[model samples]
Target: ALHLEMTGFLVVKPEGYVEEAAAGEEGTVYAEADYKTQVATNVQTQEVIDSVVVYITGRNYQDFPEVVALVEDATDQLTFAEDAKAKAEAAAGTGDWQNATLWAGQWWQYQVKAADIGLRAKTFLDEHGAVETAQ
Candidate 1:
């Protein structure tokens, strides 16, 4: 088995009984509680191990797509903020104070949106367990 870096996240509970080993699978076939020592040669036991493996390595292993989308939204908003800043600079260069102020307001709005989106994404990831909490 590959080393699971985060043991805190994946908690396994094993409740089982000893069974006779089948032919050929005399070695440890499946042992939930004492996986390193006990040998199992039963289909039911193998299924349990398979389920545990899948549970540990399935959805919890990857980032949520919505979280990634939120980050992309934040990045796009930041890009717009930069563009707004450029427009504000150009308006100021032409001595259009009103237009410059309007552009500056737009830039601020974009910045706020970006910040909100980024924060929301982080919160979502933290709540979903994709981002590990500090021990």
Candidate 2:
């Protein structure tokens, strides 16, 4: 997924220098090039699908404040969830069922939170998907 998106990804900006010809008699026209932008973002999965891109495109706009906020909130929740899951896994792996139970309980709650966040993001993106454009 990232590979396909990357093919279209682009970073266009004014660059390159114009060389002086004959001491300012005429500025040499330097070479110039430009490219388009394509964005695909995703985290790899071990399951059947090897790649994926998780992002919500905005309608005729790139600076999506609402999307940013949503992402921030979700990220925070996911971070906590990841940490909890790691702790619980470590405890269980070490045969510490006593603490594992406690941490596992917290891990379960965080897992729910993360799932909810995922749902919220999906819903928002689906409702506000950008008008698809070819570059």
Q: Which candidate's lDDT is highest?
A: 1
Q: What is the TM-score of each candidate against the true structure?
A: 0.49, 0.46
Candidate 1 local lDDT, 1-135, one digit each (tens): 124435565544457855678776444222222321211222233354344333423333236788667667766887897798788768767766566666666776776676666556656655778634232
Pairs that collide in candidate 1 are none
TM-score, model 1 to reference:
0.49
Name the 10 consecutive residues with the lowest summed lDDT in model 2. Answer: 33-42
- Model 2 misses residue 71 by how many Å? 1.2
Candidate 2, residue 10: lDDT: 58
Candidate 2: what lDDT?
0.47
